[model samples]
Target: MQLSSTTSGKAGSNPMGEGAPIVYVVDDDISVREALEALIRESGWQPRVFGSAQEFLSHSRTATPSCLVLDVSLPDLNGLDLQQQLASTRNDMPIIFITGYGDVPMTVRAMKAGAIEFLTKPFGDEALLDTIRDAIQRSTTALGQEAELQLLQKRYASLSTREREVMALVVTGLMNKQVGGKLGISEITVKAHRGQVMRKMGATSLADLVNIAAKLGSSCGN
Candidate 1:
């Protein structure tokens, strides 16, 4: 069964992975690509097959959790180099590497670079399936964390400039009077702002609020 990647709007399109997860296979061998595509379809994931790394990179990837099944031997770009490039861009798609001429050094490089699985040719379907399942689980976890961080950032962004200053001071163990003195404001005003900060951040305790501030400050470089 030949799957047309352009049947929908996106290039090398699978169903959008927003609702369901996606699995992408990049193998030069047509038979291998087709076989994996069939397997992925049977598992109810959206699968997109690409013949080269460039093709895969050019595709517009959705923000949903996705796994990449890449052949180590590619014509234009080395699989390891592609992995490096993806990492450089902060793309966290889990990868499964497959190769017919796989070697020890190659395996080490791919694994060290964070490939979920390194599969040699003639690998069992069950082995590949299990690996894919693990990769998907990892991808889902990563996506969840990223989504949570984004939401936290949005809540932090909702803070007013003055409220942000108060938050930073309060998280640093400053008393209301100390915060008020630092900002040339009244202690009562500081108390009001602190209460607003707690409400806006949905923080129940000062320790939890401090943790949230730490996450923000870490991202903000102090």
Candidate 2:
């Protein structure tokens, strides 16, 4: 199987040997599954092939960077239906659809549902591999953002209620005096809570604290 020039250059760049990104293939056809497995492995990704959507769904998903190469027609649930099932649970797992009998509406629906690429077989090996690479890159980015958000949430959870109150106020450009007035506390107490919020949230400056609050979606209560 010939890889795209882009795939060739990137195939050897993966530094995570045993923990390489996974490319899942869910197709009823044995031949297509085997072919994709070889190409995916050659391109330096772990390939997990399933004969049906149910089999794929049964597999335990890890938090590794990964994407799915799904055939539109499956023995059980169709690819689009499977995509729907995964939408809420696995937003980080990008999907690339492949089928020999693709249609305009099918393509539109798949793309609308956030599929990375929809290829009708016999698509070129290069195209499939290239799309898989792009999907994996997208998954990597999404997973990173998710992990960051989770960590941020954990840090936010660690704050005392007073510190959270101070953060909500401080990030909204409130002075310690104003925050204290709003919360019915002394300015010195507000300053102490603000310092704790900054330390707990890992914010070096007020601007940094503001950004963190925005990400946390904290409503600065009046």
Candidate 3:
């Protein structure tokens, strides 16, 4: 049951890039797992199947951005429980639930928990594929935002106390002379600190520095 051999729409397109954004299938049914693995591969995604939620959880890499095709009824951990566990850990991976017998209340619960889609058994291949594509796009965007936040945090961590003060003043639209006056430092000293702040923060322009500060939600001054 290889998905790569199937002829689906634009099977060559790997939207999330090669070997990234895998479609993880977690189901207790062996046949369902194999079938889904084939389907995902055929849609030009890397697929990994697990027979139980525990197996999936053990094998998952927390940092990797991926979408889950989870069965609502699992042997060890059910889909809802797994979703809650992932949420507790702040994992934002998008989930699409597949169930053999799901009612309106169950679907409502899944949707409220941030599931992208709730698919019943005998679901259409196209519907599942579309939902997975949407989920992948969202996951990619989220991962990129997280990466940017991490870089901002690292840059912010590199600034000295005085340099941080200078940065805050600069982003607050203060001139070097005004910043020096406020901090009781000479303009020459303020200029040096400004240069150091720019270099340490990897900001090419004052606007860039301001944007980074805004994204980090850090106060410009004490």
Q: Which candidate has the top score in lDDT?
A: 2
Model 3 ranges off by over 4 Å: 1-20, 62-64, 88-92, 218-222
Write one digit per residue (lDDT tens) for candidate 1, span 70-136. Answer: 8988989978888888885545589999988888999999999989889888888888889888988
Q: State the C-alpha lDDT per candidate.
A: 0.81, 0.84, 0.81
Q: Residue-wise lDDT of candidate 2 within 35-123, one digit each (tens)?
A: 77777877888878888999898888888899999999999999999999999999999999999898899999999999989988888
Instruction: Score candidate 2 by lDDT.
Output: 0.84
Query: Per lDDT, what order, best first?
Result: 2, 1, 3
Please give the lDDT score at residue 117 for candidate 2: 92
Model 1 regions lying over 4 Å from their true place:
1-18, 220-222
RMSD values, in order shown? 4.0, 5.0, 5.1
lDDT of 3: 0.81
Which pairs of residues clash in candidate 1, taking residues 3 or more apart in a chain or in different chains?
Answer: none
Residues 1-222, model 3: lDDT tens digits: 223333222212344456566888888877777677778776777777787888887773646567899999999999999988887564457999999899999999889988989988888888889999999888888888989888878888888999988988899999999999999999999999999989988889999988988887844454
Candidate 1 positional error at 147, Å: 1.7
Report how far off residue 116 is in candidate 1 (Å): 1.8
Q: Which lDDT value does model 2 have at 84? A: 93
Candidates sorted on TM-score, descending: 2, 1, 3
Error in Å for residue 82 of model 1 = 0.7
